[model samples]
Target: MARPKNQEQRRQALIAAALDSAGSKGLRSLSLADVAKRAGLTRGAVLYYYEDLDALLVEAHKAGIQRFCDRRDTLVQSLDSPGDQLAAAIRAGLPSGPDDALMRLLYEFDVLAGQSAVHDELVEAMYTRQLAIYTSVLEAGTASGDFAPVLDIETLAMNLVALEDAYGLHIVAGNSHITVDKAEQAMRAASTGLGAPPTPDGGETPPA
Candidate 1:
């Protein structure tokens, strides 16, 4: 028999299994049984961690979003320089690779959210939390002068996220129009804007 896991470990294992299953089969046909089998645990074991299947799905969604948001929090917390911090946010939002299975699961939830009365609440909560976090980061950037002063924080944040989503689709379709590096440069330029006065040589200092 396998060694027993602690509460946190069991919870994490369930979440990871759910995410993997959702990524492979999407939320449309996902089942608690499948997740339990994938995690190498009994269905009852999965239930011990999650109250129900919907609860399990919610935890999976939380885990997926937490991956990106945790990186954002780390980058934001570590930087004293606003420029570098904003850059870090942009980087964090970028797709780490072409797979984007977690993103696909979230998208699947979104598409099915309105149709399924059973899943709507969990789906809506996921969207609300993700949007709120992105908006908060954008507003904080503006307040710190990490972003252009004129852009509306809420709109800009949404647009930036939209752009990332679009680019991610491009990658999924096997046509990479913009590299992550190019996206970063374009975003930085747009954030800085052409109208901003050129900083005189030696005006900007490196992060200490």
Candidate 2:
């Protein structure tokens, strides 16, 4: 007989399975049975962890947010320059490609924003968190004299987040011409518009 999973293990397994299903089948089509099948568990086993499909969806969304935030934080820590930091943040925030499950799931929740109160709250909180990340980096750059002092940090931060949201949606929607490279270039242009200094590469020239 196979060994039984502990409570935490089982919960994590189900969450992983949920993301797998969302990635492969798209979040709109994700079902409890699909998650159970991905996890190699029965539907009853899935219920033991999550009360319903909504509960699992919420958990899965939270997991994706945590993963994205963690990755951006780690990437920022390795770089010293503010321009580099800003560039890194933009690159990190974007989806890897159309096949990126985490970004796809995030945008899926975004599409359902007004219909579900729970989803609306999650989306709001996510926006706040993302904006804060940009604000922190921009503030640090300004204080360190690396970025232009004339810029409005809050507005720029909000714009960056908005750009990411729009471009991410386009990428997830499978625009064949809209690759990650193009998205990053657009973000870099926005960053320069905000008076950030040019990066070493020819691509990241700050606005005068």
lDDT tens digits by residue: candidate 2, 111-162: 8789789888889888988898889888998999888835689988999999
For model 2 the TM-score comes to 0.90
lDDT by candidate, in order shown: 0.66, 0.83
Please, what are the lDDT tens digits per residue for candidate 1 over residues 81-102?
A: 5555556666666665557787
Model 1 alpha-carbon drift over 4 Å, by segment:
1-8, 47-52, 116-147, 194-208
Candidate 1: which pairs clash?
Answer: none
TM-score of each: 0.70, 0.90
What lDDT score is found at residue 160 in candidate 1? Answer: 60
- Return the top candidate by lDDT: 2
